[model samples]
Target: MIRKLLLILFGMGCVALQGQLAYEGVVLDADTGTPIPFVNIGIVDRGVGTISNENGEFLLEFRPREVQQGDIVRISSLGYIPRKIPVSLLNDDVLKLIIRLQPNPVSLEEVVLTDKEYVEVEDEVGYRDLLGKGIGYWKDSVALGGELASKIRVRKGLRRLNTLFFNVLHNPSDSVRLRVNIYEPADKWGAPGKNLNESGRSILHVLRSHEILTVIDLKPYNIWVRDDFIVSLELLGVFGTENISLSLPAGNLPGVPSHRRYTSQGSWERIDDSAVGFWLQSTFYTDKPRKANKPRQLRKREKKEREISGTVFEIISSGRSEMRSRRRGATISNYTSNKSVKTDEWGRFRIKAVKGDILGVSYPGMYQVLTKVEEISFYNFQLYPVKN
Candidate 1:
C-alpha cells in the first residue's frame, strides 16, 4: 500500500511569532504497511534528532525560521534505506501523516582465502579505564540529542570485529535505548563521516541494570575494516528519568586532545577547558599482529626533525601521533572548512590550507582571534582572559 504523508498547514495560529506549527507523523514500511519502530528522524547535522515511539509515531517541535526550502529531515533505520523529506512539505492538523520507508538489505561479502598460512591474531583495544568520574549527560548537563564520538585507531588490513566494549560511567534511568554506530574517517578533516557498518541492521542495545562495562557483539554483522575508524554511542531515547551517559576516565594516556560537538552537523569545539577522557574498546580478529605504537617522546623528536614531512596533517590514523602532536597544543579552527587542529606547545600546527581560509585561534575564556590565510604558512596567537 503506497501512502503520501498528509500534512495540514496551521499557518501561524494562536500564539504566532512568524508561523506556529506542530509536527506529528508516523513511519511505516512501504511494502508491509506496518509501523516501523525507533526510526531516526532528524535534520541532518542540525543537532535535531528524535525517534519514533513503539507505536511508530513521532512528534518533533521546530522553532520558527528553522525550516528552509533546501533543508531536509532524514529518516534512518535498520534494514531500510534512509528517507529524506523536504521542509516545505511539513504542516500540522493531519490525522494520518504516514511516511513510508523502503527496505535496504546489505549484501554479505564472500570471504576468499589462499592456501598460504600466516598468522591469526585477536586483540582488545580502546581506553578501558574506570576512574572516579566521566561524561554524565542529562544529569550533569542537558540531554543533547546527538552523539558523542571518539576516534579509535586501528591497524590497516582486514579484521573481524568481535565485540564493542564501553564503560557505563553512570546510569540513573531505569532503562534506556542506545545505538552503536561505526563510521569511516572523513576525507576532508578526518571527522566521523560515512556510515561504515554496512550490515543495514541497527546495532541497538537496551540497558536494564547499570553495569560498569557493557560489551556488544559485532560478529553477527561480519564487519571488516582497514585503517582507522570511529565508534559512537548514540542516545536513542530515555525511559523513566532522563539520566544516561557513556563514560570514560578523566583523560587518556595524557597529551591526547578531545573535541566536543552537539549535533552530527553541528560545529565542533575543542574540549580544552579540561582534559575529559573518551575511550571505546573493541576486540577483533586478524591474521597479523598489531603494530606497537611508537612512544610519544620518540615521535616528537622525529616530528621536530620534520621526518614525517609534517605528515601534511597532524591527525594520523594510528592516533599515536595525535597526542604526540597536540599536547598543550593550540586549537586552530578553520572557519572556512569547519575543521579544527591544534598546535603543539612549541606553537606549531598543520592544516590543509587554501587561499581565503579564515582560521580562528580560540580558548575557553579568551576572545578569539581570526586570521585570514594569505601567502603565509605560519601564524602566532596569544589569548587573554575575557573581561568580566
Candidate 2:
C-alpha cells in the first residue's frame, strides 16, 4: 500500500509538469483592417495573460489542464471591441484575429495632431496620449469674461499621411452644431509669370487645392468624405469644366513630393516654393468661468452688456501663417446678447457676456457650434478650403 501511494504521488508531479500550452496570433481592427498593439490576451480559467506587441501580435501560454480544447481565450483593449474564441476550434498554432473596435462615442473636448506633418499609409485615428490628458485651444481673452478657449494637441507620432480625427463633446440637452469650412491658399508659389518649383513638378500654378477638412462630424463613425464625392464627380464625368487628370493620383504619401506640375514642362523655379492655404476654425464651449470677487459696476445711461457672452471654439491650420489671415465681421448671437465680430488675419475673434449664458458662434463657411460664456476665453475652430 505504501508503494502504491508513492507511485500515485509521482504520477501527479508528472501531470503538473506536462501541462504547458502555447498560443500565438495577431490582433487587428476588423473594420479598417488596422493592427492594434498592446492588446491583452488571457485564458479565462487559468488567469494566464499576455500582451500584443507593436505589430499587434501576442504569444500566450497556459497549463494544458487549466485550458482545455473547448476552453475560452479572451482578447481585448481600449478603443476596440473585445472578443473570446474557443480554444478547441482554433486548429492552427499561429492565429490571425481581426478584432474590430468601434470608436469611443464620448464628447471630444479637443483633437491633437501628434505629428505636425504626419504622412503614413496606416490609419492612426485613435487618440494616443494617456487617456484623460489633453491640451485645449481658445480664441478670446481668458481674462475679460471671454468664451474663447485654448487649443488641444495630442502626444504621439501620427504617420504623416494618416488623417487625424477630433471628437468634440456636448451636453445631450445642448444643441451642438458643426460646420465645415475649407480655406485653400492661392498659388503663393508662383509669380504672375515665374512658377514656384522644388522638384520635377512646377509650382507654375495651383495644380489642385489640398483639402483641409476631411471628416467634420460631431458624432462618432459618421465620417463624410467630400474628397470621395469629388472623385465620384470625376469618374461619372458629371460636368464639363476645368482640366482633369486621370493618371493615377498619388496615394497618401506623407512628406512625399507631389508629382503634378503647373507648367507643361516638368521644371521648378524655386527650391522651396509651395503656395497653398487651408484655414479651419471651430467654436465650442464648456461651463462658464467664475466671476471675480470685485463688486459690479452699473452704467447709469446705457444698458450694460454681460461681462461674458458665450464660449468660442477655434482651430486654425498648422502649416500656414496667421499674419496673412483675418476674420471680419462674423456675427455672434445669444438669446440675451446679439453681437457681431470678426477675427484678425490670425483667425482671431472675440465675444462678451456674463458666465453661464449660452453663446452661438458661426463663421461664413464653417460649421456653427455653441458654447457657454466663460471668463476664461476659449478657442474652438475648424479648417475650411480656401477657394481661388
Going through the candidates in the order shown, the clash numbers are 1, 74
lDDT of 2 at 102: 48
Q: Highest TM-score among the candidates is held by which one?
A: 1
Give the whole-model CA lDDT for all candidates, comma-separated.
0.57, 0.34
Instruction: Give the range where candidate 1 is weakest over 10 consecutive residues by summed lDDT.
Output: 306-315
- Per-residue CA lDDT of model 2 for 330-351, tens digit only, reads 4555422323465554555665
RMSD of 2: 24.6
Cα displacement (angstroms), candidate 2, residue 106, comes to 4.6
lDDT of 2 at 351: 57
lDDT of 1 by residue, 1-388 (tens): 1225434333442233356545677888988989888787777656555678778888665575666667877877778878776765654334334677888866766878877444544444445453564453333332333566666656565555656755556676777777777777675445667777777777888764555545465667766677677676666677777555445445443433344455433434444323333332233334443333433533543344311102112222343533223324556765433446866665566775565445566556655555557653555555544658
CA lDDT for candidate 2: 0.34
In angstroms, the error of model 1 at 156 is 1.5
What is the RMSD of candidate 1?
A: 19.4
My TM-score estimates for the predictions, one after another, are 0.61, 0.24
